[model samples]
Target: MAVRKIEHVGVMVSNMEASIAFYRDVLGLELQGTIGHPDEAIKLAFMGAPGANETQVELVEGYNGGLPAEGKVHHIAFTVDDLESEIARIEKLGVTFIDPAITTLPNGARYRFFYGPDGEWLELFEPPAK
Candidate 1:
């Protein structure tokens, strides 16, 4: 079978409220909803852009210990039309950029990384226009 698109990325968080606020209020993603799994003692919050159908960021709660030191997964990246404007908007929310400036890949794509409320790494990527 051929691979399609990414469905979602699951992130284990210590505080669901803070995670939700960072992804929704600070990052401007909409909270689709939350699911409670009593058996697993977990709560899942799905978030994405308005009108987006694929690739959601799922915030997970009810796990023990703090955020992972380093997971197999590195960071979740979102594509944006205007990286500068997006960075400015997020900066206004008090999010600091990991890089001093936007980094350009050899292929000409631009990207930047930052930490979420729970110290989860996230990225903003912009591909060169066609």
Candidate 2:
């Protein structure tokens, strides 16, 4: 079977409100929806990009469960144009960047990595102009 696109990334947060604010306000993600899984005693919040994109970030909270890992899964990256502005905006929200903007690879593709509320890593990629 051919592998399809990723539906979403699940992240567990101790506080759902903070997670929502950080993602919605800082990252500019829209809170598509949220649901209460009574059976599991967990709440799931789905967020999507502002413009055009189906990829989503699922915030799992109130479970008091185990954490996956910090930087172990590495990070989930998304394409962005203004890395500087994005970084500044997120930093103002108290988010920390693991590594500031760095240019690597022979092609000199610009990219940066950062951490969210629960230390979930994320990468922002800015591709070379075509």
Question: lDDT tens string, model 2, 1-130?
Answer: 1113444566777788999999999999998877655335677687899774667887877654565555223346666676667667777888788864564433444667788778777666654567
lDDT of 1 by residue, 5-122 (tens): 4446777777889989998888899998776553367776889998886788878777544646666344576777788888888989899677788877544667688989988777
Error of 1 at 53 (Å): 1.5
lDDT of 2 at 121: 71
Worst 10 residues of 2 by lDDT: 1-10
Candidate 1 has its poorest 10 consecutive residues by lDDT at 1-10
lDDT of 2: 0.67
Estimate the TM-score of every prediction: 0.49, 0.48
Each candidate's clash count: 0, 0
- Residue pair clashes in candidate 2: none
Tell me the spans in candidate 2 whose CA falls farther than 4 Å from its real position. Answer: 38-40, 65-130
> Model 2 misses residue 8 by how many Å?
0.4
lDDT of 2 at 41: 64
Instruction: Give the number of the best model, judged by lDDT.
Output: 1
